[model samples]
Target: MSQPRATAIGFTAVLLWALLALFTVGSAPVPPLQLNAMCFALGGTLGLIWAVATGQLSALRKVPLPAFALGTIGLFGYHALYFAALRNAPPAQAGLIAYLWPLLIVLFSGLLPGESLRPGHLFGGLAGFAGAALIIVGGGTGFAPEHLTGYALALACALTWSGYSVLSRRFGTVPTVAVALFCVVTALFSSLLHLMLEETVAPQGLLGWAAVLGLGLGPVGLAFYTWDIGVKRGDIQMLGVASYAAPLFSTLILVLVGIAEPTLRLALATVLITGGAGLAARASLRRKPTVAVSASSDG
Candidate 1:
């Protein structure tokens, strides 16, 4: 992909991520877990069929299956944390905290590629950290002991997501759709495991029911395709900048729905996150891919 289109695709993925947040919180009567499982099932099925029909199932075998597998499991955690956080924390707070994956990715990138931290990276990192701290202090939802697990899960979600992003860079030729397929496959297994070993809850109504499909088509499947193609084909770092938009969009959705009460703290968080991450990602954008891997390595 050209740099411009890749940039658009990345930002577009952020919109998809935001939509995932919106539907998850807005699905009032749906048991989020069940809905998640249903969505992944449908998405995986669709992707699997498409790949097989096109004789592209071989693409799955060519990518880094281990990294992809771990990433998919992380995606499962992300789904759970996001759904629970919406109920436990304010929508904006949840969005902000969850989106901290960018900083986590930045930090992790330092460890992986031995990239020296730049002035912009330092300031950006600080900004994102401060933004998160401010958001936490702004107090949309009180930090309760019950909310402890939710917060931990949310942080884990961010970290795991960062890990996935870094790991994805290891594979050079894996198609974006293949990545989506792997994630959905992993999610399907994780959901099934949850259903069997844990308590299962179902959506309460048609709106919630439709949310399952929407989640699959919009965020779970298509978003992955957009993101993989975007980041994979160009500067992954530049593509990452679009992620900051997710919280902004989520905040708007929350305000429109009357679930998120506006505050100056949120505004600061937005500026810090967008500005900081953007600065940091710009530094990363300077990086050129030094190694290439074949899809055959996936098997």
Candidate 2:
């Protein structure tokens, strides 16, 4: 696939991700496990229907069990930590911490075959981290001791997502099939967790139900499939740069929705993150020529 097309797909996925916190915050009454279970269950059902229609359901049986297991755990684990992070701390702060996965992806991309860690990537990542620090410190909450658990969970969320993306790339699989399996696994695990650990909390109104449906159809389902394809076939460096957009978009959306107020700290964070991502992606300017494959229909 050409870089531009793949990057577009990745961008769509990130755009959906920007709405995640807004929906999650709106569903504050719902437990993470229950939310995860409901969203993934809906997503998995959608994916299954798509797969069957596309004749990909048969391919699922051919995928190795280990790959299924890894994909499932990765999908479930990241959200589990992320949902906990949102519940434990202010959504904006916790969101920034979890967004660190992009930088981690850039750094860890070096572990994959033929990929190298470049100086621009490292420098940009540091700048982004500095920006994140500004947001955390100046974000009104000011590092309260009570929110430490949220911070920790957010960090784990970053690690889990980074690891998942890198590992998914390292192990090639059919994107649709893998995503379907992972969603199913996540739904099961989250259901179990909900049953064992959470009290029942149902969506109360139109907005609440909308949040659940949007999350199910977008972030938890289609977004993951697109992301898998992007990371596997798209320019990894470019995706790294594009990913910072997620947090920027997320924060802006929250502000628009009145969940958060615009602040100088956020403005600076946007500049820093955007600048850093541009610098990091600058290395992609030197890519060697490759055959352009049409990826638009692949999904």
Candidate 3:
């Protein structure tokens, strides 16, 4: 796929993720790990079927073991740390810290080969972070020293995801189909954790079941495959900046569905996140990619 097309495809993941909060709310009664297990199981199963139908099943055999390990760990570890963080601290505070991945992705992309860190990228990243922070912390929740453990875990969650995303570039040769296996393994891990940690609570109704299906098909399933293409071949810096829109869009979705009330804060966040993304997009469009040492060539 062309770089532009791949980037567009990747942005769809962000759009899909906007529905995460809404779906999770609708999927009530089900615990987080159980929900994760069900969604990923559905996603992975559908992905495998798609692979078979498209004759991509054979291609999966060529993927390196390290890629599988990385993908599974990235997916599973992130949620584990996030759930732990929320348990140790306030949700608002812990979530704010965890949302640092987008900024981290932009910063970390500077170290990637053939990617230049522009002033616009840095400024845009900060702007986006500020906007996201405003939305997350707008409830007047303050961090307490008592929550240090949760805060640390939340930071680790950010590092795990950002590191996973940036390092994914090095494995550009890995087929996106491999994400199906990753999701499957992640589902197994989640199922084990759910069984060990919490009692099973099935979805409450049709709405809950539908929400789980939606999450599986969109956010948890196709999003990973498209994101693989974007991070590996598209403008990583731009996508990093653009990711800030997820939370903002999520809020808007909530408001549209009558789950959240609109506020001045939301309007301001709209400007900052969109403006930051636009600035980064302009810089990405103006600058040309240069020949540099490939990340895969490094030890």
Candidate 4:
């Protein structure tokens, strides 16, 4: 596919992810691990069905074991931390902090062989962290001790996802079909963890079940497949900048649904985070020709 087309396809994942926080909140009362198990199971089953129907089952066989392992760890670790974060902290705050992955992706991409870190990238990182600090410190009221663990987990969630996305570039030859196996393994792992650690509380009512299904079908399911294609083949830097939109849309969803209130602090933090990502993106774009050459060569 053309680069622009792939990038556009990849951006769809961002749009889908905008609903992640909302669906996650709606799926609540169900423990994190259990929620992870349920959503990934549905996602995995659907992915496998698509693969079979498209006659791509043989393509999956070509994917290396290490790739499978990496994909599983990324998917499982990210959602587990995210689900737990929202449960422990206020959803809007925690979700914003976790959304730092896009900025992190921009920063981390500088470590790629042909990409050079610029002053703007460093400054952007600081700005993004400042925003996160605002969230954690509760707009200068000092640490919200009760939510520290959740904030910390959200930070870790950002790191895990950014690392996964950057590293996935190295496996550019791997077909997106392999994401099905990743989802399957993640489901199994989540199920095991839920069984061992979490009490089984089923989703409460129609809204709850709808949330789980929404997650599986949209954010958790097809998002991964399209993202795999985008990051592996499309404009990664562009996607990184575009990702800031997810948090904005996510928080808006929460507010509209009455799940969270729109506050000055949230708005300010969103500005900081989005501004930081834009700075980093500008640096990346300045060297776009070189980066594109390197990406093509690497792929």
Candidate 5:
């Protein structure tokens, strides 16, 4: 597919993921590991069916084991931490903390074959970090000492996801195949974790089931599949910049759902993360000319 189309799909994934924070929170009362396992298993089943129908199941054999392993760890590890963080902290705070992956993605993308690190990226990363600090200090959420564990988990989520995305892009194969395998692996791991550490709590009402379905289909299922293609083929810099919108979008949804109240800290965090991404992307744009020139000379 064309880069433009891939970029659009990337943005679509971002929007869906924004809604994910809200839905994940709705699953509360449900154990994190159990919830993740069930949702991911369902999503994986859907993806597997699609892969078969689209004739991409054969591509699975071509996918290297390391790539599939990393994809599973990235997907499952990130969500595991994310769900735990949401359970312990306010949705906005957790979302803001986890959204740090966008800045990390910009930095990691520079390590790709045709990408380069620049001064703006450094400054932008710092700015984003500063924004995250402000969120924590300015009464965003997670003030108690007990909440520190969740905060740390959210931070780890950011790091794991950024590294996962970079590696995926650097070694991407067929999107559907990769995502399907990732879901399967994550589901198995999550289920195992649930058995070891958490108790199961089935969804109680129509609203609860709806939340599960939304997350499984939108974020866990289609979002990861499209993201695999996007990071491989789309403008990574653009997606990095676009990801800053997630926290803001998630916060709004939480507010609408009456799960969270908006705060001054969240507003400031929006400015910082968004502005930092723009600053980093400016560097990306400047570096593109060099990449184009290099490609041309090589050709």
Candidate 6:
């Protein structure tokens, strides 16, 4: 397919994957390592399939090893910290904090030349954080001591995500299939760790096993592959923008399941988040003006 069309679809795929991730949180209560192992095991299979189908498996070894290693380490770090934070903090709060990854990305992006935040980004970041705060504070639970600890870990998750984003950029031009292969390899290694350290592989019967595989094949693997494709197709900006929808979807799921309830404060927080995100997205959509005029730009 043409690049533009591929990019547009890729953004949609990202939204789907993010949504799947939100739902996958409470689907099964297994240990995070076991969950990662299962999901990644599935990811390896799926990634291998795509690689073979695309006839790119032969070139897979040629992908820069350092970049792949960084990506792998980034993945491992984010998930481990995230699982640890979940031990202490409510998942909703922890998840919300983790969602700040985009903001983290924006902050880090400034360090790199040729990438600067625009007015839209400022507005979006504010709005996104506002939404996150709503999701964190308004989720009908008071903050516990563990919550604070978890929040710290959540911040680490954000940083790890930023690291992955940077690492992935090194292979930004690489095909999504290749990236998927690297992720699959990372998943395989993580799964092996699960076997060696934990004596894991919970025997929760078929349904439990299904959840594990779903975590891996569906959200972890399939969704990620689509996302990689989106990145390679040059829709990272759009994909990034749309990804702000993640916490909102996740929050709604929790609320619907009675895990969280809505309050006036929560409502207000949602408004701020929505308003800010809307403003930011609109701002980002505006065209950049010529260098002749930098004194002011409404967007």
Q: Alpha carbon lDDT of residue 187, candidate 4? A: 93
List where candidate 1 sits over 4 angstroms from the true fold. 49-55, 61-64, 80-98, 111-116, 132-137, 140-152, 197-202, 239-241, 281-299
Off by over 4 Å in 6: 1-7, 17-27, 88-93, 111-113, 139-150, 196-206, 232-238, 254-270, 289-299
Candidate number achieving the greatest TM-score relative to the actual structure: 3
Weakest 10 consecutive residues, lDDT, candidate 2? Answer: 289-298
lDDT of 1: 0.64
TM-scores across all candidates? 0.76, 0.87, 0.95, 0.82, 0.82, 0.79
Pairs clashing in candidate 5? none
Q: Any residue pairs clashing in model 3, and if so which?
A: none
Residue-wise lDDT of candidate 1 within 1-299, one digit each (tens)?
Answer: 45556657656777886777667754555555666666777667777776777777877776576766755666676676666676676555565567778667655655645344556776676676676667544555555666666666667668767777766766546666576566666577667766765676666588776766778777776676667655444445544444555666666677788878888878878888789767867776665544433232211
> Tens digit of lDDT per residue, candidate 4, span 1-299?
66666778888998898898789888989988888888888888888998888887787788898788789879998988887888888766786678788778877877776556777776776676666555545544333679999989999999999999888888877878889899999999999989999899989899999999999999989899889888877767667766766666676787898977888977887988788777866875676454342232211
Could you report the Cα RMSD, in angstroms, for every candidate shown?
Answer: 4.4, 2.9, 3.2, 3.9, 4.5, 6.2
How should the candidates be ordered by lDDT, best one leading? Answer: 3, 4, 2, 5, 1, 6
lDDT of 2: 0.78
lDDT: worst 10-residue window of model 1: 290-299
TM-score of 2: 0.87
Candidate 2 lDDT tens digits, 1-299: 66667767877888888888788777668877898898998888888898888877877787777677768878998988987898999877887788788888888887877676777777777777667656544635655779999999999999998888877765654454568878988999999988988899898788888888888998777888888877876767567766776767877998998988999889988888788877777866654544443343447
Q: In each prediction, how many residue pairs overlap at the backbone (N, C-alpha, C within less than 3 A)? A: 2, 0, 0, 0, 0, 1
Q: Write the per-residue lDDT of candidate 5 for residues 1-299, one digit (tens) a residue.
A: 66666667778888887897778767667877888887788888888888777777777777787887788789988988887887887666666678778778877887788777788877777676666566544554455676777778888989989888777775644454558778988999899989998877888788788888888888777788777766776767667766766656777688787887888878887888778778876776676553221110100
